[model samples]
Target: TVFGLVVKDYDGDGKKDIVLGGNFYQSKPEAGIYDASYGLLLKGDGKGGFTAVKPQVSGIVIKGAVRDIKEIKAGNNKLLIVAKNNDKTEVLSFK
Candidate 1:
């Protein structure tokens, strides 16, 4: 259950990358909670192919139930603002 998504060239390869945030706190009793996903980073190859990058490698781990993701420019830097439920907001920048 992806709650948030942002597409941009995070790796400076001229190809688009994807950041995914997903979590669900509510579900049926049989289904239990949907909180397994910490987040995911998908790097595109510009040929309709994508590779999943681990959070450790990407350094974009987002915990909790994500609600939204926004891109903002802070002076000379571009940043990602992640919003989640019952959790502190996360700000991210790629080096």
Candidate 2:
């Protein structure tokens, strides 16, 4: 199941993109737990529409079922810090 989503300009092209987080590894959602899901990136065409795109951060596949997505700004950099339930967080930069 899809757990969280983020819409932002990932490519710095003035177009908003979509980053979805969720897990499908576990067929069923465990109670009080975040289900595992892969991340899917969608590129926006500046016209308020989007298309599925495989997101990569520094050529690494960024996928996980994050219970919370917190956007952190470190200087001019934009990053999505994904936090899981009782697990270590992952930092993914879509730059």
Candidate 3:
């Protein structure tokens, strides 16, 4: 089975305005070959819908898949996201 996911803002927003990624099953027969999906940036409309601002494609080559996302306050008008990429760790920030 193909493993994938979708993410969205819990608050009211027409745009998704969030990042989502996961593992996916291979369509063609390949041995020991794994493809990583890209991260997406969503935009919320504040109405109740979302649009994909960015498509899913890996920007960074990490060790593993991003299992979870945690948001933290980085600074005024800025936020940080701590994610677990397989056995490795990564940090993403936004302003």
Best by lDDT: 1
Tens digits of per-residue lDDT for model 2, 12-92 = 888987776765344446544444446677789998888776434423244555676767787788888877655678887
lDDT of 1 by residue, 7-63 (tens): 988898999989888889888989889988888889999988899998889987788
lDDT scores in order: 0.88, 0.68, 0.47
The alpha-carbon RMSD values of the candidates against the true structure, listed in the order shown, are: 1.2, 4.1, 5.7
Model 2 poorest 10 in a row by lDDT? 54-63
**Please, what is the TM-score per model?**
0.91, 0.71, 0.53
Ranked by lDDT, the better of candidates 1 and 2 is 1
Quick one: ranking by lDDT, best first? 1, 2, 3
Worst 10 residues of 3 by lDDT: 54-63
Candidate 1 clashes: the total is: 0
Which stretches of candidate 1 lie above 4 Å from their native place? Answer: none
Superposition TM-score, candidate 2 onto the true structure: 0.71
In model 2, which runs have C-alpha deviations exceeding 4 angstroms? 24-36, 55-60
